[model samples]
Target: MGKLTATFLKEIILLARDRSGILVLFLMPAVLVVVVSLVQENVLKTAGETGIRVLFIDHDRQSTGQVIEELLSGSGAVEIVKDVDGHEIDEETARTLLAKGDFQFCIIIPKGVTDGVKKRVEQQITEALNAGNEAQNEPVPLPSLAVYFDPLVQGAFRASVVNVLHRVVLSMEMEMKARALSNMIPVRMNLILQEIMGPNLINVPVGIFPRMDSKWGSERLLDVKIEPASRGGVEELPTSVQQNVPAWALFGMFFIVVPLGGSLIREKQDGTMLRLLTLPVPHVTLLSGKVIAYVLVCTVQFSIILLVGRFVLPIWGMPVLEMGSSPAAIVLVVVSAALAAAGYGVMLGTIFRTYEQASMFGPVSVVIAAAVGGVMVPVYVMPEFMQKISNYSPLAWGLNALIDIFVRQGGIRSVLPEILYLLSFFAGAMLIAWGVFIRRGRTGG
Candidate 1:
């Protein structure tokens, strides 16, 4: 314990003396988080302003088709474009517009839609009455509402648009049914009264149907309810802050490889490693102390970056960090992530032979990993192949874990898989580094 403490203090003192390392470890990540957050916020705001574009082609040109068009045109979330250059678009033209990125989706309301829906509703009610069963019979087929979408559009957004169209069609169907029921009541009631009282007994013909209660008379054939994924009681943070803070922080943590590896190379080249081996401290203890010191440094780095996101950025008129339900889970992620990064640094330090090699390659490799791991761009926005490959980056694991805690409002169990992966990376790198050190000792190199 005493020797480990001594070695730990020695490493801290040495690292503290290096001003450049201190700046990189502390200041660089904070600056990056703020800058990236600002940029992402702006991008999101601009994208929100550009509402989803859709093409509406109405062959019906009747009341039903006109109703749908009116609903879509008035929607703030969707923009409906009907024509180009004072010419109406057909299905083929709509497809062309979609291909050209003029619209995200297309909807075609087929001809005779309003008349067909009215006919279908009449047939449904007549069939139900003839069968002496009010059990909901299947609705008659009407002209289909055809939807065509650009393959490039996101599946989730495309599905949302489809759902909106479905609701519109359903409402139209309901209106037709209500009208059919109203027309039936007077005829059906007169026939029953004539049969009971004998023909010409009353000498009066009924001309009106009594008003029916909407709630009891109207039974919706299709009811669609949408539930969002976010659970209650958990505050969702801004996308920019939730994503950028952890991503940039992970990038900075992994960059500790540059200084840590360079220091090792410097010691090995100057024969300081040989001198340390002769001292009373075991070689393993010496390595452990360096690892411990850097782990602390990484923790500090993580904390500073988070503070900037939570407190400092908000004052600058940017989004503030919204914490998750589990503070303990967040701390666990930070510690595990820091260990993984420090372990990687030690492995890099041992593998590289010179300070120049370590300094050049360590930061470059970290930057590449950061780019792939969603530090620069989100993984979801990347091509499918790139997203699959991003899983291999340890930094990706760390960033995902942090997001689960902070944005997803997940508990400790929710991020166990990511935590395990990070620990495995630490263990694997540390073992390889240990082997390299053992091989060097045996050869006196």
Candidate 2:
């Protein structure tokens, strides 16, 4: 027990004196969280979470055009720009801007759409109403809408925009058809009544007919209720800070492998490890001390990032980090991740004979692990094979557990699988290090 405590204190002192190691562990992730979160916030805005800027040139400048602008504005999905440089934007100018990628979308309402649509719709309804006759009404031409999009716009985004426009136009067309039918119904009824009793209907007032409203066609018959999918808990919306903080914190924590590996290499090269092996204490005790010291460093690293995310990030107009109700789960996850990281460090140190090899390999391997683990992008968004590959990364396990707690309002049980995976990885890595350490001792080179 005394040996273990002494070794732990020594490791801590060595780590404190290593300025480069301290910088790698602390400053890098702090800056990563702040910069990446702000950049992602802008990405969210571009995705229309806040709003997308759209160039709307309504050449028809009548009812259909006015209605399109009003409905788009009410939906709150886009910022409508009808004018550019103090002048009403023409179709040619809007097209030029879209092609240049200065604007993502441009909508043009073709001329005579309103009058043409109304005339065509009324004629179609009239023809349909008198279907028993010869049906001699000619087909009237209707103007189609033109929607120009930037070449770089994604297919999904274009589909979404097209869908919104389709719904709005369909609603307007249905209302127009309804109004035309309403007008024709009274006319047909009055003609029949007059033909049947010409003199008897002389004093009849027009007020006897039922009133029709344009809004009636737009009202939905059945409504859909949207509910959140949560574990019957208060649903927390994930913000950029919430995501990047945990992601890069895991990144920094795993980076402990660098210093841990370097420390091991230094001791081996200086004959300190050989001298320590001569002592009565088991090598596992020495490893335990290194693990404990680095785990404490990792915990502090996680805390600094949390504090920055909760307090400092919000000052930059970011959402406050809402750690879920389970603080115990968070602590457990951090410790498990730190242990896994330390074990990897010890393994690398045992295998490598020089600090340069350990330093280069340690950071590079961690970056590869982080890349596959959903640190930079969510696993679901990756290609199919990469998604399967991500399941094997320890960083993925830690990141998943943290995200579950941070956004899903999860508890200990919610992250049990990830915790177990991380702990298993720690155990596996240590065993490999032990095997390597014993083999080298017997060779006596």
Best-performing candidate as measured by lDDT: 2
Among the numbered candidates, top TM-score falls to 2
Q: What tens digits encode model 1's per-residue C-alpha lDDT throughout 102-174?
A: 7778888888887887778788767755575555566768568888988887776777777777767676666
Error of 1 at 91 (Å): 5.7
Give all TM-scores, in the order shown.
0.65, 0.87
User: Clashing residue pairs, candidate 2?
Assistant: none
Q: Write the per-residue lDDT of candidate 2 for residues 361-401, one digit (tens) a residue.
A: 99999999999999998899899999999999999999999
| Candidate 1 regions with alpha-carbon error over 4 angstroms | 1-51, 70-96, 132-141, 192-208, 213-240, 255-281, 311-318, 324-333, 348-432, 442-445
Count: clashes, candidate 1:
0
Q: What is the C-alpha lDDT of each candidate?
A: 0.81, 0.87
